[model samples]
Structures are given as structure tokens and as C-alpha cells.
Target: MGDTGESQIKSGQGYPVLKPVGDSAICIEFGDEINDRVNDLVYSAADALNARSPSWLRELVPTYRSLLVHYDALAADYDEVRSDLLGLAASDSAAETSSSGGARQVFELPTVYGGEFGPDLDAVASHAGLDSEDVVRIHSSIAYRVYMIGFAPGFPYLGGMDQSIATPRLATPRTRVPAGSVGIAESQTGVYPAASPGGWQLIGQTPVQLFDAQAQPPSVLQPGHFVKFVPVDESEFQRIQAEVANGQYRVAHSEFAS
Candidate 1:
């Protein structure tokens, strides 16, 4: 989409900044920082737009602190759409949508830390000035929020990792990191959904299949969801792997107030 000459527009105080992202899309920025409150606004905007069900609406892509709205330029006037977006942004419903305490799905991922599966576990532990066992305990202690799914298919960019175990990425990225490999890079922790080159510190590996082409809504993880790592033994990992391969395993999940 080519950039339209439309200048940035603000709906007023507390509302998002709407900027034209080419001729067919608009970037609705909620805030300048990456945090839960800003993310909630992004989700709220998306929810409000979807509820309106405008014919011109094509897709709503929610990012860390903004919502990208794609529209059918031929069917709808840009000014009208912009006005509608501003109206929604300033409405009480939009604020209420975000403030409503709703349940968010939390997936429990069983992981096996260290050994062959996690080649960089020792390096990570050494960097953190702690033992491998302590590293594992600290890593799995809290539930992480899935900020956005990108970089690779079903790959979740997670947040809320304890800074104590934070480690930098590999000096030289591996040519190929195995799928289901859980890695820590700086303050973020995420799982490699498929076999691909990556640089995150490999501390653990989960047996869950993150992406399955044959299944409906292939990606097991979704944006705005939570992931809780459950450390498992080698035997348990093997059992879960076998079950996953046979299409019998179901990732343990529950709902918690967001």
C-alpha cells in the first residue's frame, strides 16, 4: 500500500494517535511503550472495530502497542473510516471493553531443561551466576504473557520473565534450532515453533507441537494468552513426545482473570 498524504490525526486526550499507513491501512498507536495497559488498549480497539463490522474493514493486526487496520479503499472513503475510528476510540465502550476483567487462557507447557535438548543451558546458568537447577526453577516460576506471534509460524514472543535469569543471545546464532526448543534472549523467553535458525539461549525444550498444518487454526499459541512452563524429566518428555506424535496429547490449559 502506497503512503497517502494524510497527516497524523489525534482523537483527543487519552485516545490513540491514528496515522495513515499507506492508502489502504491505518496504524492506531495506543502508547509509546510496551506494557500491559497499552496492550489492553490495542486489544480493546480491535474488539471495538470488529464489533462494528464495517464493510470496508479487512483485517485488524494488534501489535505491542498499536492496531493496524486494513481496509478496502475502493468501498469506503478514508475520511469516513478515520472519523469512525476516532469516534470509537473516544467512546466509553472502548474503555469499558479493556477494563472488564475477563479470563485469559493459560497453557501449561511441560518442558525438559538441560541435557542434549538444551545445549546452551550450562552457558546460560554460568552467565546468570547460578546453578542449572536454580535456573530451571526461576525460569518456570511465573506465567509469561504472549505479546505477539511472529518471527516464525506459531512462534510466541513472550513477556514477564524474571530478570534474574535473563541472558543475552548466542554470540553466533545456530544454523538451525530445533522446533519446541524454549530459549531465553535478553528479557524475553519464547519457544521455536519450527526448525529454524535462531540465537536465543536454549535452556529447555517442550514436547508440544506448536504448529500443525493439518489442524484447524494450526498455531497452538495465540497473542494475549499466557504460557506457564512446567519442568519435566526426560522420561516424561519422551512420553509427551510420543503422545504428541500419535495425535493424542492435549496441552494442559486453564482460564485465569486477566
Candidate 2:
């Protein structure tokens, strides 16, 4: 099965490939590589499907280069659904939307870097041949794209970290990483929405409640959105933490041209 799947992907030639997952899900793969263009296609396809509002459509999961579509097996035929997806993938609107620069939500998260909150800051600075301050400056300089949310609930897989500050994961995984902890593993950086065992090098921590089970959308960060980290002092961190606890903290955000 692995060999067949590899060969099929190899022969795709930049076209979307519909691969069945179990009996109810279809993975529409745009390409094998991960990039903004490929991710844009995934988002466009998801938007198109959502706008169509097919009765059998159950869920849409967008990733770096593909869209995992779940449908009601009992209500829809596999062949028909496959054909519909192909049409949608080739539609003019999908292509135009993917290329057009649309406004995207950019969430600004307040973070406290170094000290107890970021235990591995010194290690990362040493690895990068720079001071801890430089690492923080470079990290907070750009807006990172939320490629996908996986590994754990509301655990964002972010992209666009400056390569100079990139650091490797810890030799040993931590048993419990505090929730809202931001870490860098290789080229990627993300926040730990919930406390979980992880190996990523902890660099900073945010006070934002990334995941709230009672909220309408449990995950504050969604795929395709942008995240900007705003560095704050220890006192500000404590203040924001208090506001978050009291349900008074509103996450600062804006719509920017993507």
C-alpha cells in the first residue's frame, strides 16, 4: 500500500489527488511540498466546499498542503463525492481565490520571554551564537502563519520563523510543558495550547488562553491565520494572566492583507 501510494503521488504532476481515508474521509492533496501557495490552495478548496454547503459534508480540515474532507458515508456515495471534489478543485473561483490577496486575521499574543517562563532561552542563544535579547527580537519581529493545528488540541503548527534563531529540540522530552508555552523545534515555532509532554525547545510563554472547551471555537488559533508575538515584561505577563483568568482579556487582533 505504501509503494502504491508513493507512486500515485509521484505521478500527480501538480494536480490534486483524491486519496480515500477509511470509508468516510477523503484527503485532497494539492502537492507533496509545503509552502504558502500550496497552503493557499488548501484554504481555497475548503472555502469553496463550505460555501457550497453540501448536505453530506461533515467537516473540513485544512493542512499545509492538503484538505481532509469528512463526509457522511451513509448519506453520500463515494464516487459521486470524489467527482464533486475534483470539480471544485478545478473551479475558476478556487484558483482565483488562492492567488488573490485576501484579508486574514492576525492575532497579537502577549509573551514573556526568558527567565522561568523560557527555561531554554540560554541554550537557544548559545546555539545561535547570540545573546538572549537578539533571539527574542528576531522571534517577535515577524508574523507566523498557522499552517495547521495538530499533535494536540489547539496546538498550532506555525511557519515563517527567522532561520537565524532556529533551534533544535531538547535531547529529552519534558513530562509536562506549561500551557501557552512557545517553543521552537528546527524551523518551526508554535505555542503549547495545553500542558503536555513535548520535546520542543521552550523559548517563551504566552498568557493567552489558546483553547477553551466552553468557547464557541475551542481553539483561538485557526489554520491559515497569522500570529504575532508581542514581548512584555514579567509584570505585564502577570497582569494579562489575571485578566485572562477573570475572562476580561480580549485578544488583540486585526485583519491584514495576506
Candidate 3:
């Protein structure tokens, strides 16, 4: 949103270190906070660099406060890759582009908020100092921003949570958090794209599969998209779940092109 020019500003040593995760991947870290400003800048540069990535580049992974850009050591040396990363870090121009703005998608996630579907719903309500219905309303009120997709395939790291509804993770992690398990942790809320072991505070679950390996994009949602959880009754949840089980769920796409 400001000047998009290269700056020699350096993240102090031990602050935002660029280290090699593996033989081919290098991570560029920003800081510790998961604020809007930090994630926005990171995703902006990532989108721009990804749009015109070099031939040696393999994959670009964006996290809350860092970016993992994997490249070939044979075709491109570390120095060359570092130099490219420096340019990306310095330039603010990419963040100013129209495409860099909030690329939000409004998703109507049909969820079953209580009962077995949401075991921690009552706990969350107690922790938030509100009734169960109030908790559900507050949780579903905001249009959450998809910070980054990681942890599991198509798992969107959502932000813009109502602090009133914010709660810590479960003391003991669950063995199996089914796909579509909507949960909140710290100041963020997200869905379990696939069945996985997790510790987030479960509040509800959606019927749609966030990911499908057979689909073109695989994920129904992506980073920079917006999500709005729409609470539905048990019957509707069963109906949608049945559709997904039978491969009849109508997956919606975001208006990202505009």
C-alpha cells in the first residue's frame, strides 16, 4: 500500500535468518508476529515472484512469517538464489499491485456447530464467557483471511478472528481430527482439509472436503482468500457429508481473477 521500492533494510541476525531447510530449500523469515502487515507483505512478494519465477525455481511455500523458496543447486547456485531473494525482500512494488490486495473468497461452509460434531463447543463457550449460541455467532461473524496454506494439503491458515472467541489449543492433541473439523487456536480459526492429528480447539466441522487430490487445484480455498462459516443443522450436515462421500458435493471457486 506504500512505496514499492527496494530497501536495504535487513532483518537483524538471529531475527529473520535465511537458512536452508534441506539441500534445495531456503527459508526467508520475517519475524515472530502473525499480524496482518507481516503476512500481507510476505504473500504479496510471494505472489509476484511466483508469477515470474526463474527456471531454476521449483516450489514457493508461504508461511505466517516466512517464505520457503525451493530451487535447484545444480542449475542455480546459492548466491544467485540469495541475490534474487534480496531483490524480492527490498522491493515494495509487488505489495502495491492490485493482485496483492486482499484476494478474498466468500465460502459458505455448512457446519454442524454442536453435538458430536463440535465436542469443544461448550468448553469454548465457557472459556469465552458466553453462551454456546453466542460463541457460534461470534465465531462465524467475521470473514476470516486465509493467511497461508500448510500443515496439510489445502489446509488454509485463516486470520481475522474475533478475540472474544479466541481460545487456546486442547491440552492433549486429538488422535484423529477428521477432514472438515473447524477449529480455533490463539487468534486464528481454520478447517482440517483432511483427517490428521491436531491440537486446535474444535468448535465445529464442515461437510465439504477442503482438498481432493483428483481435482485440478485440489484445495477449495487458497491463501489470500476469505472464508465465512455457515452453520447448518444436523440434517443438512448429514446431507452435505453424504454428497461429499458420494462425490456429489458442489465445490465453489473464488473470484480471484478480478
Could you tell me every candidate's TM-score relative to the true structure? Answer: 0.91, 0.92, 0.84
Q: What stretches of model 3 exceed 4 Å from their correct place?
A: 1-23, 88-95, 252-258
How high is the lDDT of residue 215 in model 3? 90
Q: Per TM-score, what order, best first?
A: 2, 1, 3
**Evaluated with lDDT, which candidate comes out highest?**
2
C-alpha lDDT of all candidate models, in order: 0.85, 0.87, 0.79
- State in Å the error of residue 145, model 2: 0.3
Worst 10 residues of 1 by lDDT: 1-10
lDDT of 2 by residue, 54-117 (tens): 9889999889878999999998889988988888877746454654478889999999999899
Predicted candidate 3 versus true structure: per-residue lDDT over 1-258, tens digit per residue: 112222213322344457878778888877556655556666776777787678879988888778888999898888888887777666746554655554456777888897889899999999988999998998778777788998789989888788888899999999999888999887778999888999998889999988989997888887767788888999988898899999988855455532
lDDT of 1 by residue, 83-169 (tens): 889888778464556554678889999999999888989998999999999999999998888877877779998888888889999
Ranking by lDDT: 2, 1, 3
Candidate 2 residue spans exceeding 4 A from truth: 1-12, 92-95
